[model samples]
Target: MKKQHFLVKQMPPEEIELEKKRAELSILEDDLALKELDLTTLQVVLEDLRRRYLRIVGVKLAQLDGIEAQIAEIIARLDPKNEEVKKEADRRRTQAQESADATGSIAAEEYEAEPFKPSEDLKQLYRDLAKKVHPDLAPDEQARERRHRFMQEVNQAYSERNEDRLRSLLNEWENRPDSVSGEGTGAELIRIIRQIARVHNRIEAISQEVENLKESELYKLKMRVDETQDESRNLLVEMAAEIDGQIEAAIARLKNISQRVEKTERSRTKQRDSKR
Candidate 1:
Protein backbone atom coordinates (compact mmCIF):
# COMPACT_ATOMS: atom_id res chain seq x y z
CA MET A 1 0.00 0.00 0.00
CA LYS A 2 1.10 3.60 -0.67
CA LYS A 3 2.35 5.52 2.40
CA GLN A 4 0.27 8.19 4.26
CA HIS A 5 3.11 10.70 3.57
CA PHE A 6 2.69 10.04 -0.14
CA LEU A 7 -0.98 11.04 0.09
CA VAL A 8 -0.03 14.30 1.83
CA LYS A 9 2.56 15.00 -0.85
CA GLN A 10 -0.05 14.75 -3.63
CA MET A 11 -1.08 18.38 -3.07
CA PRO A 12 0.41 21.56 -1.56
CA PRO A 13 -0.42 21.91 2.16
CA GLU A 14 -2.52 25.06 1.67
CA GLU A 15 -4.46 23.44 -1.18
CA ILE A 16 -5.20 20.44 0.99
CA GLU A 17 -6.26 22.72 3.85
CA LEU A 18 -8.55 24.63 1.49
CA GLU A 19 -10.20 21.41 0.36
CA LYS A 20 -10.75 20.36 3.99
CA LYS A 21 -12.40 23.65 4.83
CA ARG A 22 -14.60 23.44 1.72
CA ALA A 23 -15.77 20.00 2.80
CA GLU A 24 -16.50 21.26 6.33
CA LEU A 25 -18.40 24.19 4.88
CA SER A 26 -20.46 21.85 2.72
CA ILE A 27 -21.45 19.77 5.76
CA LEU A 28 -22.40 22.89 7.68
CA GLU A 29 -24.46 24.12 4.75
CA ASP A 30 -26.35 20.84 4.73
CA ASP A 31 -27.08 21.27 8.44
CA LEU A 32 -28.35 24.79 7.85
CA ALA A 33 -30.57 23.51 5.08
CA LEU A 34 -32.38 21.12 7.43
CA LYS A 35 -32.79 23.77 10.09
CA GLU A 36 -34.32 26.19 7.60
CA LEU A 37 -36.69 23.52 6.35
CA ASP A 38 -37.89 22.83 9.87
CA LEU A 39 -38.51 26.52 10.50
CA THR A 40 -40.44 26.97 7.27
CA THR A 41 -42.55 23.90 7.89
CA LEU A 42 -43.47 25.10 11.37
CA GLN A 43 -44.38 28.52 10.01
CA VAL A 44 -46.62 27.03 7.33
CA VAL A 45 -48.43 24.75 9.78
CA LEU A 46 -48.92 27.49 12.31
CA GLU A 47 -50.23 29.89 9.70
CA ASP A 48 -52.75 27.36 8.48
CA LEU A 49 -53.87 26.74 12.03
CA ARG A 50 -54.24 30.47 12.66
CA ARG A 51 -56.43 31.03 9.61
CA ARG A 52 -58.63 28.08 10.50
CA TYR A 53 -58.97 29.23 14.10
CA LEU A 54 -59.94 32.73 12.99
CA ARG A 55 -62.53 31.41 10.56
CA ILE A 56 -64.15 29.19 13.13
CA VAL A 57 -63.83 30.52 16.66
CA GLY A 58 -62.64 34.08 16.12
CA VAL A 59 -65.66 35.22 14.10
CA LYS A 60 -68.04 33.84 16.70
CA LEU A 61 -66.13 35.62 19.44
CA ALA A 62 -66.43 38.81 17.43
CA GLN A 63 -70.16 38.36 17.26
CA LEU A 64 -70.30 37.88 21.02
CA ASP A 65 -68.21 41.02 21.48
CA GLY A 66 -70.65 42.97 19.30
CA ILE A 67 -73.68 41.86 21.32
CA GLU A 68 -71.93 42.61 24.60
CA ALA A 69 -70.99 46.04 23.25
CA GLN A 70 -74.67 46.72 22.44
CA ILE A 71 -75.58 45.73 25.96
CA ALA A 72 -72.86 48.06 27.35
CA GLU A 73 -74.07 50.94 25.18
CA ILE A 74 -77.64 50.49 26.42
CA ILE A 75 -76.41 50.44 30.01
CA ALA A 76 -74.35 53.57 29.34
CA ARG A 77 -77.42 55.37 27.93
CA LEU A 78 -79.37 54.49 31.07
CA ASP A 79 -76.58 56.13 33.14
CA PRO A 80 -75.77 59.00 30.75
CA LYS A 81 -73.51 60.79 33.28
CA ASN A 82 -71.13 57.82 33.59
CA GLU A 83 -68.36 58.79 31.17
CA GLU A 84 -66.33 55.68 32.02
CA VAL A 85 -69.17 53.36 30.99
CA LYS A 86 -69.65 55.30 27.74
CA LYS A 87 -65.93 55.08 27.01
CA GLU A 88 -65.96 51.36 27.75
CA ALA A 89 -68.95 50.93 25.44
CA ASP A 90 -67.24 52.85 22.62
CA ARG A 91 -64.03 50.86 23.04
CA ARG A 92 -65.89 47.53 22.95
CA ARG A 93 -67.90 48.57 19.88
CA THR A 94 -64.76 49.65 18.02
CA GLN A 95 -62.96 46.45 18.97
CA ALA A 96 -65.90 44.27 17.94
CA GLN A 97 -66.23 45.96 14.54
CA GLU A 98 -62.49 45.73 13.92
CA SER A 99 -62.52 42.06 14.81
CA ALA A 100 -65.45 41.51 12.44
CA ASP A 101 -63.61 43.32 9.64
CA ALA A 102 -60.48 41.28 10.23
CA THR A 103 -62.42 38.03 10.14
CA GLY A 104 -64.07 39.08 6.91
CA SER A 105 -60.70 39.73 5.25
CA ILE A 106 -59.56 36.11 5.28
CA ALA A 107 -60.00 34.65 1.82
CA ALA A 108 -62.30 31.67 1.49
CA GLU A 109 -59.93 29.90 -0.90
CA GLU A 110 -56.96 29.93 1.50
CA TYR A 111 -58.14 27.03 3.64
CA GLU A 112 -60.34 25.28 1.10
CA ALA A 113 -57.53 23.27 -0.43
CA GLU A 114 -55.93 20.22 1.13
CA PRO A 115 -52.97 20.77 3.45
CA PHE A 116 -49.52 21.51 2.02
CA LYS A 117 -47.39 18.42 1.42
CA PRO A 118 -44.25 18.75 -0.67
CA SER A 119 -43.10 15.88 -2.78
CA GLU A 120 -39.81 14.09 -2.07
CA ASP A 121 -38.22 15.55 -5.20
CA LEU A 122 -39.27 19.08 -4.27
CA LYS A 123 -37.82 18.68 -0.76
CA GLN A 124 -34.50 17.27 -2.02
CA LEU A 125 -34.19 20.00 -4.62
CA TYR A 126 -34.84 22.69 -1.97
CA ARG A 127 -32.17 21.20 0.29
CA ASP A 128 -29.67 21.12 -2.58
CA LEU A 129 -30.34 24.77 -3.51
CA ALA A 130 -30.13 25.89 0.13
CA LYS A 131 -26.77 24.20 0.54
CA LYS A 132 -25.46 25.84 -2.62
CA VAL A 133 -26.81 29.37 -2.10
CA HIS A 134 -27.52 30.02 1.58
CA PRO A 135 -26.42 33.56 2.52
CA ASP A 136 -24.52 32.33 5.53
CA LEU A 137 -22.04 30.56 3.21
CA ALA A 138 -20.96 33.78 1.51
CA PRO A 139 -17.35 34.87 1.89
CA ASP A 140 -18.12 38.63 1.83
CA GLU A 141 -20.90 41.01 2.84
CA GLN A 142 -21.85 41.89 -0.74
CA ALA A 143 -21.98 38.25 -1.74
CA ARG A 144 -23.99 37.47 1.41
CA GLU A 145 -26.60 40.09 0.49
CA ARG A 146 -26.77 38.82 -3.09
CA ARG A 147 -27.16 35.28 -1.78
CA HIS A 148 -29.86 36.49 0.60
CA ARG A 149 -31.91 37.89 -2.31
CA PHE A 150 -31.56 34.69 -4.29
CA MET A 151 -32.38 32.59 -1.22
CA GLN A 152 -35.57 34.55 -0.63
CA GLU A 153 -36.79 33.60 -4.10
CA VAL A 154 -35.66 30.07 -3.44
CA ASN A 155 -37.61 29.96 -0.20
CA GLN A 156 -40.69 31.46 -1.80
CA ALA A 157 -40.63 28.87 -4.56
CA TYR A 158 -40.20 26.10 -2.04
CA SER A 159 -43.03 27.41 0.14
CA GLU A 160 -45.32 27.74 -2.86
CA ARG A 161 -44.36 24.18 -3.90
CA ASN A 162 -43.57 25.39 -7.40
CA GLU A 163 -40.98 22.92 -8.56
CA ASP A 164 -40.73 24.62 -11.94
CA ARG A 165 -39.94 27.95 -10.28
CA LEU A 166 -37.26 26.30 -8.15
CA ARG A 167 -35.71 24.70 -11.21
CA SER A 168 -35.75 28.03 -13.03
CA LEU A 169 -34.06 29.67 -10.05
CA LEU A 170 -31.38 26.98 -9.98
CA ASN A 171 -30.71 27.53 -13.66
CA GLU A 172 -30.51 31.28 -13.12
CA TRP A 173 -28.07 30.88 -10.23
CA GLU A 174 -25.83 28.60 -12.29
CA ASN A 175 -25.67 31.21 -15.03
CA ARG A 176 -24.90 34.07 -12.63
CA PRO A 177 -21.28 35.39 -12.68
CA ASP A 178 -21.06 35.54 -8.86
CA SER A 179 -21.69 31.81 -8.54
CA VAL A 180 -17.95 31.28 -9.15
CA SER A 181 -15.33 32.42 -6.62
CA GLY A 182 -11.55 32.41 -6.72
CA GLU A 183 -8.57 33.75 -4.82
CA GLY A 184 -5.15 32.72 -3.43
CA THR A 185 -5.39 29.52 -1.40
CA GLY A 186 -4.55 31.29 1.88
CA ALA A 187 -7.11 34.03 1.32
CA GLU A 188 -9.74 31.47 0.31
CA LEU A 189 -9.06 29.46 3.41
CA ILE A 190 -9.52 32.54 5.60
CA ARG A 191 -12.79 33.31 3.82
CA ILE A 192 -13.98 29.77 4.44
CA ILE A 193 -13.13 30.06 8.14
CA ARG A 194 -15.09 33.29 8.41
CA GLN A 195 -18.00 31.75 6.53
CA ILE A 196 -18.00 28.79 8.88
CA ALA A 197 -18.16 31.15 11.86
CA ARG A 198 -21.10 32.99 10.24
CA VAL A 199 -22.84 29.71 9.56
CA HIS A 200 -22.51 28.73 13.20
CA ASN A 201 -24.01 32.04 14.25
CA ARG A 202 -26.90 31.64 11.81
CA ILE A 203 -27.55 28.09 13.01
CA GLU A 204 -27.69 29.31 16.61
CA ALA A 205 -30.08 32.08 15.63
CA ILE A 206 -32.36 29.62 13.86
CA SER A 207 -32.36 27.37 16.93
CA GLN A 208 -33.34 30.31 19.12
CA GLU A 209 -36.16 31.25 16.73
CA VAL A 210 -37.44 27.68 16.68
CA GLU A 211 -37.41 27.59 20.45
CA ASN A 212 -39.36 30.83 20.63
CA LEU A 213 -41.92 29.56 18.14
CA LYS A 214 -42.41 26.36 20.12
CA GLU A 215 -42.88 28.29 23.34
CA SER A 216 -45.55 30.62 21.93
CA GLU A 217 -49.19 30.36 23.03
CA LEU A 218 -50.26 30.10 19.41
CA TYR A 219 -47.97 27.15 18.81
CA LYS A 220 -49.18 25.45 21.98
CA LEU A 221 -52.76 25.87 20.81
CA LYS A 222 -51.79 24.55 17.41
CA MET A 223 -50.30 21.45 19.01
CA ARG A 224 -53.46 20.86 21.00
CA VAL A 225 -55.58 21.37 17.87
CA ASP A 226 -53.38 18.93 15.96
CA GLU A 227 -53.69 16.36 18.71
CA THR A 228 -57.45 16.68 18.57
CA GLN A 229 -57.28 16.24 14.78
CA ASP A 230 -55.45 12.96 15.24
CA GLU A 231 -58.26 11.84 17.49
CA SER A 232 -60.84 12.60 14.73
CA ARG A 233 -62.25 15.47 16.80
CA ASN A 234 -62.37 19.09 15.62
CA LEU A 235 -61.16 21.33 18.39
CA LEU A 236 -61.77 24.58 16.50
CA VAL A 237 -65.34 23.61 15.61
CA GLU A 238 -65.99 22.67 19.21
CA MET A 239 -64.55 25.96 20.35
CA ALA A 240 -66.74 27.76 17.83
CA ALA A 241 -69.80 25.97 19.18
CA GLU A 242 -68.87 27.11 22.66
CA ILE A 243 -68.50 30.66 21.38
CA ASP A 244 -71.87 30.34 19.67
CA GLY A 245 -73.39 29.52 23.05
CA GLN A 246 -71.75 32.59 24.56
CA ILE A 247 -73.00 34.73 21.67
CA GLU A 248 -76.57 33.54 22.15
CA ALA A 249 -76.35 34.35 25.85
CA ALA A 250 -74.94 37.80 25.03
CA ILE A 251 -77.76 38.41 22.53
CA ALA A 252 -80.34 37.55 25.17
CA ARG A 253 -78.71 39.93 27.64
CA LEU A 254 -78.64 42.69 25.01
CA LYS A 255 -82.30 42.21 24.23
CA ASN A 256 -83.22 42.29 27.92
CA ILE A 257 -81.15 45.43 28.52
CA SER A 258 -82.62 47.23 25.47
CA GLN A 259 -86.21 46.38 26.54
CA ARG A 260 -85.52 47.66 30.06
CA VAL A 261 -84.08 50.92 28.66
CA GLU A 262 -87.06 51.36 26.29
CA LYS A 263 -89.57 50.69 29.12
CA THR A 264 -87.78 53.23 31.40
CA GLU A 265 -87.72 55.88 28.57
CA ARG A 266 -91.49 55.37 27.90
CA SER A 267 -92.30 55.69 31.64
CA ARG A 268 -90.29 58.97 31.85
CA THR A 269 -92.04 60.35 28.69
CA LYS A 270 -95.53 59.41 30.15
CA GLN A 271 -94.77 61.17 33.48
CA ARG A 272 -93.62 64.35 31.57
CA ASP A 273 -96.82 64.22 29.44
CA SER A 274 -99.01 63.77 32.56
CA LYS A 275 -97.40 66.93 34.13
CA ARG A 276 -97.96 68.94 30.90
Candidate 2:
Protein backbone atom coordinates (compact mmCIF):
# COMPACT_ATOMS: atom_id res chain seq x y z
CA MET A 1 0.00 0.00 0.00
CA LYS A 2 2.80 2.47 0.86
CA LYS A 3 4.61 1.70 -2.42
CA GLN A 4 1.41 2.17 -4.43
CA HIS A 5 0.78 5.55 -2.72
CA PHE A 6 4.35 6.64 -3.47
CA LEU A 7 3.87 5.67 -7.12
CA VAL A 8 0.73 7.89 -7.35
CA LYS A 9 2.97 11.02 -7.74
CA GLN A 10 1.38 13.62 -5.42
CA MET A 11 2.23 17.27 -6.35
CA PRO A 12 5.11 18.77 -4.37
CA PRO A 13 4.80 22.10 -2.45
CA GLU A 14 6.58 24.14 -5.16
CA GLU A 15 4.34 22.67 -7.88
CA ILE A 16 1.27 23.25 -5.72
CA GLU A 17 2.17 26.96 -5.39
CA LEU A 18 2.58 27.21 -9.16
CA GLU A 19 -0.77 25.56 -9.71
CA LYS A 20 -2.49 27.98 -7.32
CA LYS A 21 -0.92 30.99 -9.05
CA ARG A 22 -1.98 29.71 -12.47
CA ALA A 23 -5.57 29.32 -11.30
CA GLU A 24 -5.58 32.83 -9.88
CA LEU A 25 -4.18 34.26 -13.11
CA SER A 26 -6.83 32.44 -15.14
CA ILE A 27 -9.56 33.95 -13.01
CA LEU A 28 -8.03 37.40 -13.43
CA GLU A 29 -8.03 36.95 -17.19
CA ASP A 30 -11.70 35.97 -17.17
CA ASP A 31 -12.63 38.96 -14.96
CA LEU A 32 -10.72 41.33 -17.25
CA ALA A 33 -12.61 40.04 -20.28
CA LEU A 34 -16.03 40.50 -18.69
CA LYS A 35 -15.21 44.04 -17.50
CA GLU A 36 -14.13 44.98 -21.01
CA LEU A 37 -17.48 43.88 -22.39
CA ASP A 38 -19.37 45.83 -19.75
CA LEU A 39 -17.30 48.90 -20.48
CA THR A 40 -18.13 48.77 -24.17
CA THR A 41 -21.82 48.27 -23.48
CA LEU A 42 -22.03 51.17 -21.02
CA GLN A 43 -20.24 53.57 -23.38
CA VAL A 44 -22.51 52.79 -26.33
CA VAL A 45 -25.78 53.04 -24.39
CA LEU A 46 -24.86 56.30 -22.67
CA GLU A 47 -23.78 57.95 -25.90
CA ASP A 48 -26.94 56.90 -27.72
CA LEU A 49 -29.12 58.16 -24.86
CA ARG A 50 -27.28 61.49 -24.81
CA ARG A 51 -27.88 62.08 -28.50
CA ARG A 52 -31.59 61.27 -28.42
CA TYR A 53 -32.17 63.37 -25.31
CA LEU A 54 -30.42 66.37 -26.80
CA ARG A 55 -32.33 66.10 -30.06
CA ILE A 56 -35.70 66.11 -28.34
CA VAL A 57 -34.78 68.91 -25.93
CA GLY A 58 -33.31 71.02 -28.73
CA VAL A 59 -36.42 70.84 -30.87
CA LYS A 60 -38.60 71.98 -27.96
CA LEU A 61 -36.29 74.89 -27.14
CA ALA A 62 -36.43 75.99 -30.76
CA GLN A 63 -40.18 76.08 -30.65
CA LEU A 64 -40.06 78.24 -27.51
CA ASP A 65 -37.54 80.57 -29.13
CA GLY A 66 -39.76 81.08 -32.17
CA ILE A 67 -42.82 81.80 -30.05
CA GLU A 68 -40.92 84.28 -27.86
CA ALA A 69 -39.55 86.12 -30.86
CA GLN A 70 -43.01 86.39 -32.38
CA ILE A 71 -44.45 87.73 -29.13
CA ALA A 72 -41.68 90.35 -28.93
CA GLU A 73 -42.33 91.40 -32.53
CA ILE A 74 -46.06 91.75 -31.89
CA ILE A 75 -45.50 93.98 -28.83
CA ALA A 76 -43.02 96.16 -30.70
CA ARG A 77 -45.39 96.70 -33.62
CA LEU A 78 -48.29 97.44 -31.27
CA ASP A 79 -46.48 99.97 -29.03
CA PRO A 80 -44.02 102.55 -30.43
CA LYS A 81 -42.48 103.08 -26.99
CA ASN A 82 -41.53 99.38 -26.64
CA GLU A 83 -37.89 99.70 -27.80
CA GLU A 84 -36.82 97.13 -25.19
CA VAL A 85 -39.20 94.62 -26.75
CA LYS A 86 -37.65 95.28 -30.18
CA LYS A 87 -34.15 94.69 -28.80
CA GLU A 88 -35.28 91.49 -27.12
CA ALA A 89 -36.73 90.25 -30.41
CA ASP A 90 -33.42 90.95 -32.17
CA ARG A 91 -31.45 89.14 -29.45
CA ARG A 92 -33.71 86.10 -29.48
CA ARG A 93 -33.46 85.97 -33.27
CA THR A 94 -29.66 85.98 -33.10
CA GLN A 95 -29.66 83.28 -30.41
CA ALA A 96 -32.07 81.13 -32.38
CA GLN A 97 -29.91 81.44 -35.48
CA GLU A 98 -26.79 80.45 -33.52
CA SER A 99 -28.63 77.46 -32.03
CA ALA A 100 -29.69 76.37 -35.53
CA ASP A 101 -26.10 76.58 -36.76
CA ALA A 102 -24.67 74.51 -33.90
CA THR A 103 -27.30 71.73 -33.66
CA GLY A 104 -27.84 71.44 -37.40
CA SER A 105 -31.39 72.38 -36.43
CA ILE A 106 -33.20 74.68 -34.01
CA ALA A 107 -32.37 75.15 -30.27
CA ALA A 108 -29.56 72.79 -29.28
CA GLU A 109 -26.90 74.96 -27.64
CA GLU A 110 -25.92 72.64 -24.82
CA TYR A 111 -22.61 71.85 -26.47
CA GLU A 112 -20.07 74.60 -26.06
CA ALA A 113 -16.75 74.86 -27.88
CA GLU A 114 -13.60 75.09 -25.80
CA PRO A 115 -10.31 76.56 -26.99
CA PHE A 116 -7.22 74.32 -27.18
CA LYS A 117 -3.69 75.65 -27.61
CA PRO A 118 -0.76 73.31 -27.00
CA SER A 119 1.83 74.97 -24.81
CA GLU A 120 5.53 74.48 -25.58
CA ASP A 121 5.98 72.48 -22.39
CA LEU A 122 3.01 70.23 -23.34
CA LYS A 123 4.43 69.69 -26.83
CA GLN A 124 7.86 68.81 -25.49
CA LEU A 125 6.39 66.35 -23.00
CA TYR A 126 4.40 64.68 -25.75
CA ARG A 127 7.48 64.31 -27.98
CA ASP A 128 9.49 62.76 -25.17
CA LEU A 129 6.70 60.33 -24.22
CA ALA A 130 5.96 59.44 -27.84
CA LYS A 131 9.58 58.56 -28.49
CA LYS A 132 9.68 56.31 -25.43
CA VAL A 133 6.38 54.49 -26.12
CA HIS A 134 6.65 54.27 -29.90
CA PRO A 135 5.41 50.88 -31.18
CA ASP A 136 8.30 50.41 -33.51
CA LEU A 137 10.60 50.27 -30.48
CA ALA A 138 8.61 47.45 -28.80
CA PRO A 139 10.31 44.01 -28.67
CA ASP A 140 7.32 42.04 -29.99
CA GLU A 141 4.19 42.43 -32.12
CA GLN A 142 1.81 42.26 -29.14
CA ALA A 143 3.86 44.72 -27.15
CA ARG A 144 4.08 46.83 -30.29
CA GLU A 145 0.27 47.01 -30.52
CA ARG A 146 0.04 47.86 -26.83
CA ARG A 147 2.63 50.60 -27.28
CA HIS A 148 0.75 51.88 -30.30
CA ARG A 149 -2.37 52.33 -28.21
CA PHE A 150 -0.32 53.96 -25.48
CA MET A 151 1.10 56.41 -28.01
CA GLN A 152 -2.35 57.26 -29.25
CA GLU A 153 -3.38 58.12 -25.68
CA VAL A 154 -0.25 60.22 -25.31
CA ASN A 155 -1.05 62.10 -28.49
CA GLN A 156 -4.66 62.64 -27.53
CA ALA A 157 -3.79 63.90 -24.04
CA TYR A 158 -1.20 66.18 -25.60
CA SER A 159 -3.70 67.45 -28.18
CA GLU A 160 -6.26 68.07 -25.48
CA ARG A 161 -3.56 69.42 -23.13
CA ASN A 162 -4.59 67.00 -20.38
CA GLU A 163 -1.41 67.02 -18.35
CA ASP A 164 -2.65 64.67 -15.63
CA ARG A 165 -3.68 61.92 -18.07
CA LEU A 166 -0.28 62.05 -19.74
CA ARG A 167 1.46 61.78 -16.40
CA SER A 168 -0.63 58.75 -15.41
CA LEU A 169 0.21 56.99 -18.67
CA LEU A 170 3.90 57.56 -18.05
CA ASN A 171 3.59 56.20 -14.50
CA GLU A 172 1.86 53.04 -15.76
CA TRP A 173 4.62 52.29 -18.27
CA GLU A 174 7.30 52.70 -15.62
CA ASN A 175 5.65 50.42 -13.08
CA ARG A 176 3.90 47.13 -13.82
CA PRO A 177 2.80 46.47 -10.24
CA ASP A 178 0.18 43.95 -11.33
CA SER A 179 2.61 41.98 -13.48
CA VAL A 180 3.39 39.52 -10.66
CA SER A 181 1.76 36.31 -11.78
CA GLY A 182 2.07 32.55 -11.23
CA GLU A 183 5.22 30.88 -12.56
CA GLY A 184 5.10 30.66 -16.35
CA THR A 185 7.16 31.53 -19.44
CA GLY A 186 8.64 34.89 -18.37
CA ALA A 187 7.70 36.91 -21.45
CA GLU A 188 4.23 35.43 -21.83
CA LEU A 189 3.34 35.95 -18.15
CA ILE A 190 4.60 39.53 -18.33
CA ARG A 191 2.36 40.21 -21.35
CA ILE A 192 -0.70 38.72 -19.68
CA ILE A 193 -0.02 40.60 -16.46
CA ARG A 194 0.39 43.92 -18.24
CA GLN A 195 -2.79 43.33 -20.24
CA ILE A 196 -4.68 42.53 -17.08
CA ALA A 197 -3.50 45.75 -15.47
CA ARG A 198 -4.58 47.82 -18.46
CA VAL A 199 -7.96 46.15 -18.62
CA HIS A 200 -8.48 46.84 -14.91
CA ASN A 201 -7.62 50.50 -15.41
CA ARG A 202 -10.01 50.71 -18.35
CA ILE A 203 -12.79 49.09 -16.34
CA GLU A 204 -12.39 51.61 -13.54
CA ALA A 205 -12.18 54.56 -15.90
CA ILE A 206 -15.22 53.44 -17.87
CA SER A 207 -17.23 52.75 -14.74
CA GLN A 208 -16.58 56.21 -13.37
CA GLU A 209 -17.32 57.78 -16.76
CA VAL A 210 -20.63 55.96 -17.04
CA GLU A 211 -21.55 56.92 -13.52
CA ASN A 212 -20.88 60.58 -14.22
CA LEU A 213 -22.93 60.38 -17.40
CA LYS A 214 -25.87 59.24 -15.35
CA GLU A 215 -25.87 62.55 -13.49
CA SER A 216 -25.89 64.67 -16.62
CA GLU A 217 -28.80 66.73 -17.99
CA LEU A 218 -28.98 64.51 -21.02
CA TYR A 219 -29.55 61.53 -18.80
CA LYS A 220 -32.39 63.28 -17.03
CA LEU A 221 -33.92 64.16 -20.36
CA LYS A 222 -33.68 60.53 -21.38
CA MET A 223 -35.41 59.53 -18.20
CA ARG A 224 -38.16 62.01 -18.83
CA VAL A 225 -38.61 60.68 -22.33
CA ASP A 226 -38.92 57.16 -21.03
CA GLU A 227 -41.40 58.17 -18.36
CA THR A 228 -43.57 60.01 -20.85
CA GLN A 229 -43.41 57.35 -23.53
CA ASP A 230 -46.73 55.63 -24.24
CA GLU A 231 -49.09 55.09 -27.14
CA SER A 232 -50.52 58.59 -26.69
CA ARG A 233 -47.96 60.36 -24.47
CA ASN A 234 -44.65 62.00 -25.31
CA LEU A 235 -42.52 64.75 -23.73
CA LEU A 236 -41.97 66.69 -26.95
CA VAL A 237 -45.63 66.38 -27.83
CA GLU A 238 -46.68 67.75 -24.44
CA MET A 239 -44.18 70.62 -24.67
CA ALA A 240 -45.42 71.55 -28.13
CA ALA A 241 -48.99 71.54 -26.94
CA GLU A 242 -48.15 73.92 -24.08
CA ILE A 243 -46.23 76.25 -26.35
CA ASP A 244 -49.03 76.24 -28.90
CA GLY A 245 -51.38 77.35 -26.15
CA GLN A 246 -49.04 80.22 -25.25
CA ILE A 247 -48.85 81.26 -28.91
CA GLU A 248 -52.62 81.33 -29.27
CA ALA A 249 -52.97 83.47 -26.16
CA ALA A 250 -50.30 85.86 -27.38
CA ILE A 251 -52.02 86.24 -30.78
CA ALA A 252 -55.33 86.99 -29.12
CA ARG A 253 -53.72 89.69 -26.94
CA LEU A 254 -52.08 91.27 -30.00
CA LYS A 255 -55.40 91.39 -31.89
CA ASN A 256 -57.12 93.07 -28.90
CA ILE A 257 -54.28 95.62 -28.60
CA SER A 258 -54.49 96.39 -32.34
CA GLN A 259 -58.25 97.07 -32.08
CA ARG A 260 -57.65 99.48 -29.19
CA VAL A 261 -55.01 101.37 -31.21
CA GLU A 262 -57.30 101.64 -34.23
CA LYS A 263 -60.12 102.94 -32.04
CA THR A 264 -57.82 105.64 -30.57
CA GLU A 265 -56.72 106.72 -34.08
CA ARG A 266 -60.39 107.11 -35.17
CA SER A 267 -61.12 109.19 -32.06
CA ARG A 268 -58.24 111.56 -32.90
CA THR A 269 -59.49 111.98 -36.49
CA LYS A 270 -62.96 112.98 -35.20
CA GLN A 271 -61.39 115.55 -32.88
CA ARG A 272 -59.43 117.07 -35.77
CA ASP A 273 -62.57 117.34 -37.90
CA SER A 274 -64.42 119.11 -35.10
CA LYS A 275 -61.56 121.63 -34.76
CA ARG A 276 -61.80 122.39 -38.51
TM-score of each: 0.89, 0.49
Model 1, 1-276: lDDT tens per residue? 975654344888899999999999888988999898888777877777777777888888788888888888888999999999999999999988988887887744556444566788888888888887889887778898999999999888887889999999888887887743666888899989998999899999999999999999989998898799899998888999998888888888888888899999999999999999
Which residue pairs clash within candidate 2?
none
On lDDT, the candidate that comes out on top is 1
Model 2 misplaced regions, further than 4 Å: 1-43, 46-57, 70-90, 102-184, 230-232, 247-276
In terms of lDDT, the poorest run of 10 residues in model 1 is 107-116
**Residue 220 shift from truth in candidate 2, angstroms:** 1.6
Q: How far is 118's C-alpha from truth in model 1 (Å)?
A: 3.2
lDDT of 2 at 119: 60
Which regions in candidate 1 have their CA more than 4 angstroms from the true location? 1-10, 107-110, 179-182
Backbone clash pairs for candidate 1 read none
Task: Tell me the TM-score of model 2.
Answer: 0.49
Query: Looking at model 2, which ten-residue stretch has the lowest summed lDDT?
Result: 106-115
